[model samples]
Target: MSHVNAALTPRARLKIGRLIVEQGWSVARAAERFDVSWPTANRWAQRYRECGPAGMTDRSSRPHHQPTKTPQPTVRKIVHLRWKQRLGPVAIADKVGVAASTVHAVLTRCRLNRLSHVDRATGEPIRRYEHDHPGSMLHVDVKKLGNVPDGGGWRYVGRQQGNKNRSDTSGKAGNSHHNPKMGTAFVHTVIDDCSRVAYAEIHDDETALTAVAVLRNAVAWFAARGVTTERVLSDNGSCYKSHLWRDTCAELGIVHKRTRPYRPQTNGKIERFHRTLAQGWAFRRFYNSETVRRKALPAWLHEYNHHRPHTAIGKIPPISRLTNVPGQYN
Candidate 1:
C-alpha cells in the first residue's frame, strides 16, 4: 500500500512515466503537468526505461544496508533476555549496556514488546487455539463477584455509606455464619471454543452439586441451539475434580479436560468471558440491591449472544456461528 501522504499512486506514477518516456515529454513539462518536482518526474522516467511499469509501485522505505545497526549477537542476547528472563526493555537494556529505546525497537521488530502477548509460564508468544467446530470444545469456569449491598455499593454510593451497609449485612441471620461477610456470587460460565457462544448462571456457591447442575443446564442450552457438547475444559477446582462432576460428564458423554496445574490459560475462554460479564453486566450499572443486579444477567447475556459483535469471531454475534440453526438472526 502507498504511504498516506504519497502524492501519487502506482497508476498515476505509471501515467507520469509513460508521458515522459513513451510520449517524449520534457521532464520539466511532465513535472508541471503532473504537479511533481522535475527530479521526481525524471526519476520515474529513468525507472520506466530501465525496469518498465513494475518500478511504479511503492518500494520499501528500509535502506538496503544498515551499517550502524546493532550486531546480530546483541540482537540474539536481547531476545534471550526477553524469552528466558522475561525482562522488560529497560531491564534488558541495563543488562546489555544499551539504551532502552534501542532495546524497545528491537523487541517491537521481534513482536515481543508486549508482555501480555507472551505466556507467563513459558515466556513464549501465546499460541492461541480454537476448535474447528462450536461443540468440539467448551471452556467452563467460575467467577466470584462481591454481592451488591442494599441501596447500592461503594461504586455509586460514597465509601462511608457503603461501609455502613456492609456492616449491617455482615452479621445478619440466614447468611454464612462461618465467614460472615456480604457474601459472594459464584458466576458459573461456559463458553464455546470456536463460536464463543456462552452460558452462565449466578449461584450462591461454587460447590460440586452446583457446578454439575450448571453443566447440565449449559449442555441442554447448547443442544437446543444444535450444538452437541463433545468436550469440556475447566480448571482443577475442587468442584471440577469431584465425583459428581465426573459422573455428570460421563452421563452427558463429554470428554472432561482439566487445565494443567497453575495454568489457567488452558481454560482462557471462560476466564476472558467472565471479564466481559463483569464489565458489560455486573459492574456496568449501579443497582439498588444484589437481586436487581442478578436480574440484569439474562438480558446482558442475550445481547452478548445475539447482538454484540465479538472481535475474535470476525466481529459478528456468537449466534452467527451456529449457521445450521434456524431463526438465529431472529
Candidate 2:
C-alpha cells in the first residue's frame, strides 16, 4: 500500500498510465495533467507496464524474508495453546516457551489476538451505510451534559476544589443521575445522513414530547432549505418508541427507523455528532453559568454546519452538500 503521504491513489495512477501507455501521450503531458512529478509518472508507467492493472493496487512493503520469525512448529504450538486454553499472550508465552511479544505477534498474524473477535456473544461485524439523498434519513439521539457552574467548576480550579464542588453539588440536585445545582441538560440532536447537516437543542428533559418537538423543528429547518426529510433513524429509547413520537413521524410524512437492540452503530451519525458537540461546545469553554453556555450552542452549531469541513463528504461544510447553494467559504 502507498504511504499516508503518497501523492496519487490507485485510480489516479491507472488513469495516468492509461493516458501515457494506451493513448500515446508524452510523459511530460501525463505528469502535467495529473499534477504529479515526472519521476512519479515514470514510476507509475513502469509499474503499469510490468503488471498492468494489478500494479496500480496497493501492495505490502513487508520484507520478503524474516530470519528472526518464529519457527513454524513453535507458531503452531502457540496457536494450539491459544485455542485450547483461551489465554492471553503472557500466559501462552509461559506454556509455549516463547517471549510474550512473540506470542502476541504470532496471535496477531493468525488473527486470534482478541478472543472477543471470535466470540459468539459479540455478534457479527456491523455494515455501515449512508442514505443516498439529503433528508432521506436523519440520525437522532440525545446526549446529557452536566451544566457548568458559575465561573466554571473543577475544570477551572484544582482537584481538591473539584472534589469540594462535587460534594457541595451532590446534596442539592434531584433525581437518580445526581450532580450539583448545575443539573443535567439533555442535548437533542438530529443529523442528516447524506449531507451531515445537524440540528441540536439543549432541553431540561428528554421525553416523547421533547423528541417530537425537536423533530418538528428540525424538519421545518430543513424544509426552509428545500430538503424534505423522508425518514428518521433512532435507537430504541423509551422516548423514541413512544406513540407520540411515532405519530409525530407519521404526521411529518417520515418513516421512523430504529436501530437493533444494543446496536447503536446503526445510528452512528448522531452518536458521532454527540462526540463532536462535547468537544466543540460543552467542553470547549469554561462557561460562567449554564445559561451562558446554552447561548453559545447556536454559534458553535453554525460553525459546524457552515464552516467546519467534514471528512466523509470531501472536507466541505455540510451546508455545501445542499443543492443550489453557491460557495460560501473556502
Candidate 3:
C-alpha cells in the first residue's frame, strides 16, 4: 500500500543506497544529499546489502509476532458464521465463546464487516455509478409525514406527557377521537444530480397519478431554472412502475429510470433530500398546527434553493449553479 507519508520512492531509496555503497558516500553525506534522515539512509544501505534491489520496494509493516492474536481456526469459524449464517458479531461471539469486540475486530480485519461489501452467496463487490451533469439525471421520491395534532404533539411536550398534550389538542385522546388513525401527508420531491436543486410538494397520497402530477410540476420547476429533465430516477415503487408514470415520462421525453430492487441509494440524491427536509422543516419548529407547518415549507425550500450552501456542489446555493435561469431570486 502506498502511504501519503512515504517521502521517498523505492527507486530513490535504491539510488541513495547505491550512492552510499557503490559510490562510497558516507551515510551522513548520502542522507544530507537526499534530504532524508541519517537513520533512514543507514537502514536503506543495510537493506540493500542484505536483499539487494527487491528490498528497496515497499514492504508490509505488519508485525511478525502477534502472540495474543485470535487463532486461525477461530477466525475461520467466525468468518463461516458471518458468511453462512449471516449472524451479527454479538451472535457470533455468543456462539464462538469470544468477546463481541474480538468478533468485530476479526470481521474488520477480514474486510467483511459490512454485509453490503459482498453478495452472501457469491462474494462480489457492489458497483456504484455517478452522472456528471446536473440536468442529465433527476431523482424523484415521496416522503410520508403524519399530520400534527391541533396544537403541538410529543416533540414539544415530554414523551411521558405526550398523551396529555394530544388530549389537550384532540379533545380527549382515545379510540373515539376524530380521525384516530392519524392521517398522513405525502411529500413528492424531485432533485437534480449535479446541482442538487430540489422541488417538492405535499399531497394526500403517493398514487401513480399524483406522482405524475408532481413529476410534471417538478420538471417544469427545474426547466424554469434552466435544468432540462432528461432522465427520471426512482425506486421500484408501484407508482414509479405504473403505465401512468411511464406514459408521463414518454409525454415529457424523459428516460424513466428505476433503481435495482432493494437499492435505494441508486436514487441517493432525493433520499438525502428527504432527510434534510425532515431535519430542516418537519422537526425544526414547534408548529401550533399542521397548517402552520405546511405553510412554512415554501419558505424553508426558498432558503434551501436560494441561500443554503450545498457541500456537494462546491458549497454554494443550488441556484448559484443554475445556467438556464438568469437573474437573482427576488
Candidate 4:
C-alpha cells in the first residue's frame, strides 16, 4: 500500500524513508512529494537502515572554532585603563597595547564615550558658564562730564545747560552749573563686560543715529582687541529704543537688554562708572578747554583699565577682574 511523503523532522525523515522503502516508492517520487531532493531522500533511507533515528538527528549550527578573537584579559585591561585614567578610547588603547579601533569597540561595549563625562562644579557636560568666558555682554551709556575752558573761555558744543564759556577766576569756583561759563560735553562710552576694556566717543548729540554709529565703531574696536559681544545692556532711552537700534541689534545677533524704566540702579555699574569718570578724570582738576578735556579721555581710559585700582575687584584694575585664563590650577 502507498502512503503520503511528508516534510518532517530528522527523526520523522528517518521513519518516512523506511516507510517509503517498505512501500517501494521511487526516489524521484519521494523527492517531489516531500519537497526534498533525491540525494536527501537517499541519504535518509541509508541512515534509517544503518543507524536508526538517533543518527538522523540534526547537529548544532555553531562553528567549532575561531581564529583571532580578542582575549578576555585584554578587554578587562581596556576597561580598567579607561576608568582609572579617564583617557579617551585611543589613549586607552595605546596604554593597553591594542588597536584604536579595538579601544572604541571596548568603550562602546562599556558605554564610555569621551562626551559622556560631566563637570561636577557646574553640572554641565558641554556648555560653559558666562562668567567663565569672554564676549558674554557689552555695557554702554552716556556720561555727563564737567566742562573745561579753552582760549580764556569754556569750549562749548551743545546747549550749555547751566555753564558754558565762563572764566572761574575765584579759587572756590568748582561747581560748573553755578559758574555759568563752562559747557558740558557728553561722552558716550562702551565697555566689555568680560575684559572691562572701554571705548569712549565724544558727541554733542546722543541721537539714535549717533548711538548706532558709536555702537558699530565700538563693536569693530572690541573685535580688534579679541573682545566680542554676544549681548548688550543699556538704559531705556529714546536712542536705544529706536527702530534703527532694534534693527542693528537683530543684524548683529546681539541680544539687547534695557534697564527697567525709571530704574537707574538696574544699570548701576555704568552709572557708577560715569560718576567715577567725572570725579577721577574730567573733573579731577581744572582744564583749559573742551579740546584739552577731550584729548585727555584716552589717557584716562588707559589708566582706568591698567593703572587705577577698583575696590569691587579686590583693589585690582577693572580689566583684571573681567578676564581670566581657563584651567588656572593655581
lDDT of 3 by residue, 109-202 (tens): 9888999775544444445455666678888888999877666767886665655545566433347544244467899988888777878899
lDDT of 1: 0.88
Say which prediction, candidate 2 or candidate 3, comes out ahead on TM-score. 2
Candidates ranked by TM-score: 1, 2, 3, 4
Ranking by lDDT: 1, 2, 3, 4
Best by TM-score: 1
Clashes of each: 0, 2, 1, 8
What residue runs in model 3 are displaced by over 4 Å at the alpha carbon?
Answer: 1-86, 90-103, 114-126, 159-182, 207-209, 236-243, 259-268, 302-330
Q: Which regions in candidate 4 have their CA more than 4 angstroms from the true location?
A: 1-132, 151-183, 321-323, 327-330
Which residue pairs come into collision in candidate 4?
Answer: 149-288, 149-289, 150-289, 163-182, 164-181, 164-182, 165-181, 166-181
- Candidate 2 Cα errors over 4 Å, as ranges: 1-126, 163-180, 324-330
lDDT of each: 0.88, 0.84, 0.83, 0.70
Q: Write the per-residue lDDT of candidate 2 for residues 4-90, one digit (tens) a residue.
A: 887898989999988889999989999999888999998899899999998998878799998987999999888777666678899
Task: Write down the lDDT that model 4 would get.
Answer: 0.70
Q: Which wins on lDDT, candidate 3 or candidate 4?
A: 3
Q: In candidate 4, what residue range of length 10 has the lowest lDDT sum?
A: 120-129
